[model samples]
Target: MKQWLQAFIAAIQFLTRIPVPVNVPFTNEVLKRSTLFYPWAGCIVGVLIWGAGLGLQLVLPAGPAAVLTLALAVALTGGLHMDGLMDTADGVLSHRSRERMLEIMKDSRVGAMGVIACILVLLLKWSLIASLMTAGAWQLWLVVPFIWSRAAMVWGMTNEPYARAESGLGSYFQGLHRGHLLGAVFSALMLSLATVYIMVSVPLEMAGWSASFAALAAYAIHPWWLLLGAPVLGMGAVWGCSRYLSKKLGGLTGDTYGAMNELTETILLLLLVLMTGWRG
Candidate 1:
């Protein structure tokens, strides 16, 4: 139990800027459990993202809800994942050797490819979220996607090999035990079930139960569908990172995994929002 607590705290430290007191001794085993916390941290990020959307509804006109929600997402996560997304984008598109790719990712300079990917992704998320708000499926927007996005992050961590040989985020999580896996999976399932129940129970304006369920079906299908897509995408990321590491420095590092998490979240959010809009 202490180890689990320690792992949770470590996860909070690893995934967010949130401060956590770490009096617990640092060991490789503790760090391994910390990987379980990454998904939960994503859950926290998702909640904040939902809160930001809610706050926007309260403070701004409906017309600007999407933009405000997008801003809040970046602000809540301190754009940490977004930065990784950009870096990974630049690296993946570089089409250079592995070493050069990693070098490009590490470089602070923004390339055209990275900039364009970031803009398009953000715009997609903003537009989808706005459409959901416009259609008044606001509560579904608040919960289901948030849980799935984090779960997707866990899927990425569990399936992908660290692109690098040492000192990277993937390396830290390598070969995590079944206990850690169960912890992440269980937390994610509980959150997902809760979100689904709320979506099913919550009334959207004057919409009938049939219509609400129909509308929420999109969100319901997202995580399961993405269960297939995320692994494919995650594999691509791992492959890209691996190539970059092998060609450049002989392996992946922690920051690269950070890049993977960010990209995965962005894609997952965009997919969920779009599906929800269609159903709503």
Candidate 2:
């Protein structure tokens, strides 16, 4: 129990800008075990998005609210994953020898292609989030992107071999067995199930006070099967994207893991927006 608690805190410390204040031993075993909690760390991030989006929409318009909420997600992660995305973009898009591409990704400098990729990703997220903001009830969808994205990283780490010849942050997580992979997927599934309740929990409480809220609560209760698709898609994104990157790079790297994360988030959010439109 103590070790698992430590693992969870280790995950939170590594994944977010949040301060744990407690000492966490980052042993190889601990680090490997920490993979299971990556989805839980994502749940922390998701709740932050849900809370911030709700608060921002109360005082600000959808445009500004979406901007601030997106900014908050970036800020909370300290741009860790975003930097990885940029690095991966610079490496894989260089059209050079595969070895040279990995070398470029290791460089601290961001290339022009990297900057372009970053801009495009942010624009997609912001626009999709803004559109979803048309109905505040849809804010719960915002939380989900972060959850599956982080979970996708776990899937990538578990399934793909590390690309780097030299040891890096991702190396510690290499050689994870199927058990770790199952744990991570389980966490994502449980969290997605919880999100279904969060979307309607408030409305359920307010239903007695307002006829409109009662109607909204009834509408908000989605079939549980609707969200089961999220974790499934998350795993699929990692399998497809990581396999491609592994083929090109010889294996997956820390940057590729981050790329998988960002890719899954965008894919999930885009699907959610389409789902909303189709429902409408």
Top-lDDT candidate index = 2
Which has the greatest TM-score?
2
Residue 150 C-alpha lDDT in model 1:
49
**Per-residue error (Å), model 1, residue 184:** 2.2
User: In model 2, where do residues sit more than 4 Å from their true spots?
Assistant: 208-214, 217-235
Instruction: State the lDDT of candidate 1 residue by residue for 81-184, as single tens digits.
Output: 67767877788688887777777877888898789878987887777778667656566435545444544455555545556543644565677555665677
Candidate 1: 10-residue stretch with minimal lDDT: 244-253
- Clash count per candidate: 10, 0
Candidate 1: pairs in clash: 98-244, 98-248, 99-247, 99-248, 163-252, 164-251, 164-252, 168-253, 168-254, 169-254
RMSD of 2: 2.7
**Candidate 2: 10-residue stretch with minimal lDDT:** 218-227
135-200 in candidate 2: lDDT tens per residue?
444556567777778878887887778889998878878778889888988887788778767656
